[model samples]
Target: MNIVVRDTLEAAEAAHVAVKQAAGLAAEEAALPFKQARLRAEEAMRNNLTQAKVLATRVGRLKQQALEMARESQAAQRQNSTTDAHRMQDSARELMKEAQELESQAKGFQRMAEATRGGLGIYALRAKAAATRAAQRVNPGGDGPLLLPPPPPPLRPAPRGSAK
Candidate 1:
């Protein structure tokens, strides 16, 4: 009779532990989708950032090319040569078209980046709001800014030959 009771107690303890472990596993499984969504959102944000960098570089190169073309056209005009003017204008027009196309493409990238960033912002805000609500429930007086302020603008060098 003593041996039977000991066996029964051991079985009951084992069953309770198994149920607890199963509950923990189920909770983790439920959270898996949220974790995956967050990861995917982060990946999209990173891709947008990379695309923005590439577009910015391309836009800079295009602007440089446009400036060079304008300088050539100006030199041709100053020389009072019809042939030079025609050649320079044609070259300038071609460069202008290329530059315009690059600008448009860059704008498209900018829009995409903005959209991705906006989506991430909304997701983060929702998560923050949820966390805040949970925290308020746990401790009725916690207060803090959920979002950080924007960064300061970059400083640039002064122009050459400009007055102080």
Candidate 2:
């Protein structure tokens, strides 16, 4: 498990570097859908962080399921049901593979959470500082997801009046 996580993290870091190299070109060619690029990137990072959390949760659940299957396989083996044991073992292997993939996805999201600087570097730093301050507040916890509220929408300008 450590090896798997270490390998995935290494791969994601490499991906992060690659993405950074291309980010300037990507940002330039892409239309500025919104006027507030830093706000958008902050929002994007928060969302990616949320996804990473969700993926990690999924991986954890999958690992538990795989463990359950292993336990059942052991029970089957004890009962002399070789066929059932084989089937359960195979299912456990599949579950482990799924967990590994989801773990890698989580790592990727974690790596990308802060990768959207591009031209928004200065603004992004300020936004991150603000967000760090905001995160200090007690996060609501329980059954519900703990997502950060998105930055407020950019203020629109007042309508122009007719020239005198």
Candidate 3:
């Protein structure tokens, strides 16, 4: 799982102002691009979810087929034939597990996309804050009291393979 920083007043206010800065689509002309963006994003997400469902369905079919094979193997075993029911049973179980994993992965990706989209405001704020910090550092004391809000803490790096 990812460890996100808890929002402090500094980060929160930056995000608030950033939202304000990104707003104001008064003109219908100004809104066209935004509307197109919204549509594109939604379409991509829909397609992704559809593909995930298709893959999950395939996995489910594989699981059912495995179960059918297991049943047939058991029937053969009952007739004193040399079919390994245990192997078929294990394969069926593994296929079932694969189906569950596929579903879980799809859900996780969906949430991640949502979070990243929602975090774009924060991303914009971060860009402004970084610029402000650089300006202040280079021209310290010379600039007439920059009234910029304090820069946010650096984002922590996610651990490798951590978001499983």
Candidate 4:
């Protein structure tokens, strides 16, 4: 009877240990999805940051080109070369367009980063803001003044009456 009781107690202790281990395994299994989701969010945030940096660099280069074009346009104008001035203005406009596109892409990445978890969103936003501030410094007035073409000359009233 003593040996049988000892065997029963040992069995119970074994069962208890198994149960505890199973419970721990169950808890880990349940947390797996959350862990995976967190990792995915972190990865996405990293990707967005990478894209934002690329766009920022592109914008910086475009801004530099625009500044150079503007200077060239000014020099042309000063030299009384209206045609060269117009061509340089067109080139500057193209540079501005490219820069604006890159800025937009960077902003999109910033928004994606903001949608993610783990403070990555904040960093993304800050990067975008810094890029914008830099662009603004290069292009004061948000895009500089519009350089619209002059309107057509008005028709003479006498010519209109004769045509009628």
Candidate 5:
């Protein structure tokens, strides 16, 4: 009889442990998507940074080319060329302007990448906070969540015959 009772207790304990293990696994599985999304966002930020670097390099080269072209146009005028020097000057100025615009755009993309990285940091912090809150809800102790208190209720309407 004692052997039978011990076997029953051991079986119950094993089942309980299995259930808890399964619950923990389920929680981890549910959080997997969030973890994947966070990683993707981080990768996207990195890609944006890389693209910005490439754009900056292109802009620099474009500016250098424009400057060289402008110098060549000036040297042509000195060589007593009969072509329209003013037209060449105007073309050089326009190319330089476009290059400057491209540089500005590259800077803008760099700023966007920086902002996205910041946002990812904030997102990670928020996810951790939310997970902590959920754990607190389940356990209610052991480094409780730093949750804020609920807001007060709205004012009720006065009764129809209430004093003014």
Candidate 6:
């Protein structure tokens, strides 16, 4: 009888260990998909951040070019080259519009990056601030006073030559 009771106790202990091991394996299997999803999300966030940086750089260049063209247009107008001034003004307007669009795109990317970053990590905060600054620089006045110069006067048709 003693021998049978000892064997039964040992068997119960073995069964307990086997159950625990099976539970652990099941937990890990259940978590596999979640882990994979997290990794994919992180990769996507990294790609978005890289693209945002590129866009911000492009916006900066476009803003600078637009400002320079605006200055040139003002100079041409001051020099009384009406046709040249009008041309430069049109070019500057187009450049500024493009810059504005790019700036908006950058802002959207930044928002997504921030949301993915999660928590209050210093690096994430700094990146968000930098993105905001870049957008501000691109747009400048932002519905307030106009940064670019006013449009040039409308073009006038040249007078017809008098018939000989």
- Please give the lDDT score for candidate 5: 0.66
> Candidate 4's residue-wise lDDT over 38-133, tens digit each?
667799988998999999999999999999999999999999999999999999999999999999999999888877855545544554555455
- Candidate 6: the clashing residue pairs are none
Q: RMSD of candidate 4 to the true fold? A: 38.6
Identify the runs in model 4 with alpha carbons over 4 angstroms from their true place. 118-164
The per-residue C-alpha lDDT of model 3 at residue 136 equals 45
- Candidate 5 regions exceeding 4 Å error are 82-84, 126-164
Instruction: Evaluate model 2: give its TM-score.
Output: 0.52
The residue-by-residue lDDT of candidate 3 on 68-126, one tens digit each, is 87787788778776547666667777877887787787676667557646644653455
Comparing 4 and 5 on lDDT, the stronger one: 4
In terms of TM-score, which candidate is strongest?
Answer: 5
Residue by residue across 76-147, what tens digits does model 1's lDDT show? 788887688777778777777776787777677767767866776565555555554554554343332222
What lDDT score belongs to each candidate, Candidate 1 first?
A: 0.62, 0.68, 0.58, 0.70, 0.66, 0.68
The TM-scores, one per candidate, come to 0.58, 0.52, 0.44, 0.68, 0.68, 0.65
- On a 0 to 100 scale, what is the lDDT of residue 9 in model 1? 53
Residues 1-164, candidate 2, lDDT per residue (tens digit)?
Answer: 34444455556657655544454334433323333666777889889999999999999999999999999999999999999999999999999999999999999998888575444576745555444333333221222332344323452222334221
Ranking 2 against 4 by lDDT, winner: 4
For candidate 2, the per-residue lDDT at 104 reads 99
Tens digit of per-residue lDDT, candidate 5, span 1-164:
34444455556657655655554455455556667778988888788788788878887887887788778788888888637555677777887888788788878878888887777766566556656555445444334233333323443333434543
Clashing pairs in 5: none
